[model samples]
Target: MHSASIVEAYTVTIWEMLAVFVAGISAGTINTIVGSGTLITFPVLLATGLPPVTATVSNALGLVSGSISGAIGYRAELAGQRRRVLRLSLIAAVGGITGAVLLLTLPPTAFETIVPVLVALALVLVVLQPRIARAVQRRRERTGSPAHPDGGPLLLVGLLLASVYGGYFTAAQGIVYIALMGMLINDTLQRLNAVKNVLAAVVNSIAALFFVFVAELDWTAVVLIAVGSAIGGQIGATYGRRLSPSVLRILIVVVGTFAIAQLLFRRFG
Candidate 1:
């Protein structure tokens, strides 16, 4: 290659690493505080020139550390939930393994085509989460029942399905987990959120292990994201809940809108 080509390649590598690092930071913060970190990181990876499957693989691996940090951050709330966490974790791990297999064996075009829709769907769930929580609360109050409806086997099934989605693309799995838990488990949202963190960590950790052994690896990007996410998770755990809800809502909406537009435009424009 010519000297100019070498210089250009070097510049691109630097920029890509920087972008991935920044995305990892944002993703970690948001994932810990709210959810939907994948929506932030995945598009940035694509814009930085990774192929679809490569971006997905790298993103999953990169977030593993973040998930661990977030879960650890919630350790206080997880004190009494060991059995629940362990049982649900097994289910999530199975779904994650299944999802990873699908990612490698299925057509890449299928996931690419649905990425935007999935992001939008997750954003909608996020945007409406407050209302959903309130509605559940209202029902409990009206019925004079603090006890959760009997989830029985159905709750497990819902979690299994959600884990499949989480394994395939983590985007807003945390939000879904919280929603389901709140509706079915009669627990405090904080405790449910703690549970969500552990379960998500399980899904990400298992999927990441699979990717490490079977899929293409981008060590530079993975390292960048891991460091960035670890730092971001700490920051988020320490101060994230103190942030203004309105400001966070605006950020999620703007970023989600941008992700949707970028996905659609890249496919069509």
Candidate 2:
């Protein structure tokens, strides 16, 4: 390449890297607060020309640090939840591994087809989260029965399924987790959010580890996201609660919509 072409190429590369880093920050913050961070980062990675599977794996791997950071930030709420965390963790791990295996085994075309649907589903879940919370609260008011301390088998099954999704796509996994636990476990939302972070960490870590061995990774993308997400995790932990849920939902919906469009274009356009 000529010197001018080399300079232009280098500039474009730097800008893309910067964009990925910013996406990571946004993703980590959102993941720490409400989940669906992948909706932010995955599209940016895809735009940078990564294949769908590579982008998903790299996003999962990069966000693990953010998950851990968010969990630590919520340690205060986690104080009495040891037994609960432990029980749910094993289930999450199994589901995560299962999902990861499915990702590896499935053909690339299957991923292209499935991911748009998954992103659409996750966007719907994000949009409906407030209603889901209110419904959960109403159920609490109507029922006089005490919550099952262990959340019973139903909770385990729900969490297992959510973890599998997290391991596969991880877009809105935290929303699904909080919804399930809120309905079944009878905890305050903050505490449930804390638990959500821990479980997210578990699922992300397990799936990332699995990918390290079997999947192709864009290591540069991974590093940029990891650093950015770690910072975003701290920001979310410190100030995320003060942010408006409506605003966050709007942002997630917008980004998710863009992602769906991009994926569809890649597949059919």
Candidate 3:
């Protein structure tokens, strides 16, 4: 009987580890390619029977590892965006910290209700991003402006808001960030995507650290996810550049739509 119990415990541990690894891999691929990995991992955590707040915190922590790996893989594209990144990073950091504090203070019922609404809004942004970018590009071409589309002020404001969302429960945070950057910068989609990864990593890392000390984290899941996501992130970032922007945009729309549908079904259906 004692041996049987020990074997069962080992089997459960292995299963949980595998689940985390799968979540990490999915997160890495989605984040690097289209940016909605949280939709996968967060639900998995919730399904594991964790409380909503704990799941969100653990998901955020695990995702940071993938984001950092993704960012580094896109370092070449990020080289020229240093100034914009620096100017915006602080705002994102502040927003993330503020969001984390708010999450800790908010009641569980409130957060449960608010998250699906936020997910739906994020889906709308993802759907509209490509068209908005085309419009911005057309305007830049019409005027023959030597200066890049300097949407810095607008970007700072958007990043602050997006970071707050990221810190709280980032399902489609990357789509929102990429959309804002596409509107504001004249850079190629690849480069803007690189910036998005780094900025997101910074915001998530900060929030994850806060939760590490203050919140009850699922360490087993965190470890497996962090390792798998890091590997998957590297793969996704490297291959993502070869993909056409239109294809990626379509993928984002599909993923965002699925996420919204799932959230709505869970909440109302």
Candidate 4:
């Protein structure tokens, strides 16, 4: 009987390890390409029978690790964006801290209701990405200008708001961030994506630190996910520039829609 129990335990552990590996790879790809990787990992964690809050906090921890890896993979692209990054990092940090605190203090019922709304908003933004990008491109072309004053202020505001969202739930956060970046920064798409990874990492890392001390976390799951996601991030960053923006944007829309639908079903059904 003792031997059988031990064998079962090992088998379950191996299954979970495989699940986390798959989640990490999916997350890394989504984070790099479209930004809804949390949707994949978070649900998997929940399905594993962890409490909702525990799953969320653990997911955040795992994602932070992945984001850090992704940021490092894009280090070269981060060079010129230093000033912009510095300007926004503090705001994102603060927002993240606030969001983490909210999660710790708020009731699960409230969070459940709000999540769907947030998902809906993220979907809208994802759908509008290409249109917004084209408008920004056109404006830049019309003026024969490389920079615009409106862009920076808008970006700061968007970053602060998005950081709050990301720090809290963070499903589809990348699409929103990428859309905002496309509108604000005149840099190459690859460089903008690098910025996105750094900002996301900053937000999630700050929140994860808080959760580490205040909330219950599944450390084993975090380790597996982090390792897998880090590998995925490197692969995505390497080939991200080769992808077509239009196709990527459409993919974001499709995923965002599915996320929103899932939320709605969970809420109403």
Whole-model lDDT values for every prediction: 0.76, 0.82, 0.78, 0.77
Q: What tens-digit string does per-residue lDDT give for candidate 1 at 1-269? A: 01247779888778778888999998887788667788888888878767878888899999988888888887877888888888888888998888888888877655557767766765675577677768867887998867533344656877787788788878777766765665567566566667887888889889999999998877777888898888777766666545555565556566667667866786777
Q: Distance (Å) between predicted and true CA of 248, model 1?
A: 8.5
Q: Which 10 consecutive positions of candidate 3 have the poorest summed lDDT?
A: 1-10
Put down candidate 4 lDDT per residue, 1-269, tens digits, no spaces.
Answer: 01247778688767877887899888986787667788888878876677878888888998886788788888888886777777778878887888788877877655557666665665565566557767878887998977753257778888788788788877777767876777676666567777888888999999999999999998887887888888888877777656666666677678777777776675687
Clashes of 4: 0
Measured by TM-score, the strongest candidate is: 3
| lDDT leaderboard ranking | 2, 3, 4, 1
Q: Which ranges in model 1 have alpha carbons more than 4 Å from their true place?
A: 1-4, 109-151, 241-269
RMSD of 4: 3.4
TM-score for every candidate vs. truth? 0.80, 0.81, 0.88, 0.85
lDDT of 3 by residue, 1-269 (tens): 01247778678667766787898898987898778798788777776667888888888898888999999999998887787777777888998887787789877554456656665665565566667767866876898865444465777888898898778777777887877777667677788888888878888898998999899898777877788889889988989877777777677678777877776676678
Name the top lDDT candidate.
2
| Candidate 2 regions with alpha-carbon error over 4 angstroms | 1-4, 108-145, 243-269
Q: Which stretches in model 4 have alpha-carbon errors above 4 Å?
A: 1-5, 114-150
Error of 3 at 64 (Å): 1.4
Per-residue error (Å), model 4, residue 55:
1.2
